[model samples]
Target: MTASSLTRPSSKASACGCGMKRRAFLRTTFAALCLPSLARGNGPSPLPSFDRCLEHFMAARNIPGGALAILRHGRLVYARGYGWAQREQQIPVQPTTLFRLASLSKPITALAILRLAQARRLSLDEPAFDRLGLAPLPGKTRDPRLEHITIRHLLQHTGGWDRAVSGDPMFMSHPIARACGVPSPPGPRDIIRYMMGRPLDFDPGTRHAYSNFGYCVLGRIIEAVTGHPYETWVRRDLLTPLGIRSMRLGRSQLRNAHPGEAHYYMADNRTAPSVFEEVPSVVPAPYGSFCLEAMDAHGGWLASVVDLMRLSAALPGHGGSLLTAEMWQELVRPPAPPVARDAHGRLNDMYYGCGWLVRPIQTPPGHNIWHSGSLPGTFTFWVILSNGMAWAVLFNQRREANGLPDTEIDGLLHLAAAHVQEWPESDEFPRYYRPSS
Candidate 1:
């Protein structure tokens, strides 16, 4: 995507929510809704002023359509769709439309683990091997550093393991069992078994890096300790309390609830036929893989913009509904002081805090705490403010475009974040964040 593509029109139209003039608003709205023959389909209502934003994005990239949901303070002030939910049949996206959340599902999964921690069923600092029943293996070829890895380390990515050697096929492949020295994959106890056997990448707590492996292990612990499937626990403990009816585990739930799901896209040229090829109706491989287990403890869940915004606002601290105030505070607080980011959001050395991406908020006066996620054809960005303000942006077209040479979704987020202003109090906007009861 080009800088020009990202640039929002300076002029305002009266009919547009951002206060643009009528003719301009109509043109912008039309552009936002316009889609190619392959992309055309029905979609939900347009968000209040998103006409310009969606128009600019869709026109530049040839994207089919997408959903945008905005929250001011704690309330969902706006949600709208720009393109078709099902392009072939021309099904429009609605407020309830479901999209594969990709890695954004991590925070939800992390929430389940955190809830367990709050209940004292598990401790973040305790050794996960024995607790999850992976201790006392045959050769104990496990990383010496592995012994030191804890639930907290996994949550924060301080576990010292690294990304896969070549393909990073942690999700698509079943080698975790081989790497961790465990038996087969795809069983309830696979993660614990694998972690107990694999060699350590480095000493626990020595450094910070992202690790899906860490969360995968933690997921096993959740089930072992809770005596329920990870998804079942999350639904009963977290989703139910928060009124998040739209979220579901794996592709099966999505297919069942959303037969009219939106089509996901990659940059036309970058994708091979094998990748862009349609996924069969049959559910595919490694059940709890990141892409598959989104509803699991690690990441493969599906949800809508409205539900995501709701989760963002609630924050769910303590014994309260979304998160206890203390948990929320802990979530946004600076990590153990390697002091990664200074006041600005720039990272010198950053680390994860529980499920959040811990970095400086980087406004005039710096704040901290934010998380961003990207996957094949989806992108999601979010920021949670200490003073009770939060914002999220979810867009569905993936791009590996010319010249810029990286993901276009990042550019989309930068554009959205640039125009976003703090939700101002007025009768026109509704308050979505109510304290968790």
Candidate 2:
């Protein structure tokens, strides 16, 4: 269906047999789903108003470009693009237009590690450095805690590097390069070497702090175990198996942009020094201010909304085809207690599982899994509801003002889902899956 059709009422009547308007029926059904008793009923929950709600949300936020895709029971129900992928050229965003996944790259990397474990290539509980045939970077005061860091710790963001205090080591490209005797912008391996010599912010597994460096280390571990580049292995093993062809590691320069990639925009229209000194003095933040290539496992993949939803569907909760059943259970399993509690001393509503953040619901179906990613000029959010429904939204411009943009998106999506009454039976995947010229 066309983007315009998403806002109009369908000719088909409500399947609920009440002769109710599609929108009203959807709103009522979704409201019922919120109740614990009705949640487990084997009824359909379609999101028909998704396109209209997303269009309104983007316009209100002045988002330059975006793509959204929704899935029901692993089937594509809604997929559309909005605004302009390149405003200067008047290029409208298409469903196939690729946008940077940003930190969403973590989940993909986490999947790779889990797959490796399934193949008996590595153990999650083993010391990561030992498995990689490396040692912690030598520091003045040797901290024995480094030896306790495991693959599971890195996946759960409990590897001890706190961005709040010591800052994200992944962004310290120049300093890492200088310290490791690498080129001006250090690669993942060089960054790992530089961080090894430093003391961890806290004891391993003591607390959860988002760490890009931890995933960067995971990338290297993938390389070490497979004896192949992280991207090469992921593309060959994880993505291609699911028929995802366009996802790949992104570049830091527009000139190096992959085919069908959208041009990124910053909210302030500001530029920063390029990661490569030899390049232009200043470049768009998404294009070159940071080294995306070095950000391999943490935040560097570029993908279309369709591809992301496909990945989501392949995940365990939604009857995924990727990991084995046992592996899937392990992926969503929460860290063992005394589980880390929030500041209020209450159990966190959500905890970072292997790669995704999981929030268990008191109602039926148990839990929901999701991941949100952001970089200088990109914002992406992916969520898989407990009832085998999944959706993903990717935007080229990320607004960095007061609160988190993705959190607002989560609210908007909930509103949209609640308002949806009838769903289009036709799948738009075949129509928009191919790249546009």
Highest TM-score against the true fold, candidate:
2
Q: Which tens-of-lDDT digit does each residue in 169-232 have in candidate 1?
A: 3343345545544433334355445455656666777666677667777777778898988778
Model 2, backbone clash pairs (residues 3+ apart or across chains), number: 4
Report residue 277 deviation for candidate 2 (angstroms). Answer: 2.1
lDDT of 2 by residue, 160-247 (tens): 7888899887777777777766676788777776777788899888888888889999998999999999999999888887778899
Q: lDDT score, residue 290, model 2?
A: 88
Off by over 4 Å in 2: 1-48, 135-142, 342-346, 402-404, 430-437
Score candidate 2 by lDDT: 0.75
Q: What is the lDDT of residue 296 in candidate 2?
A: 84
In model 1, the runs with Cα more than 4 Å from the true position are 1-49, 135-140, 164-169, 172-188, 252-257, 269-291, 316-321, 337-350, 360-368, 401-437
Clashing residue pairs in all predictions, respectively, total: 34, 4
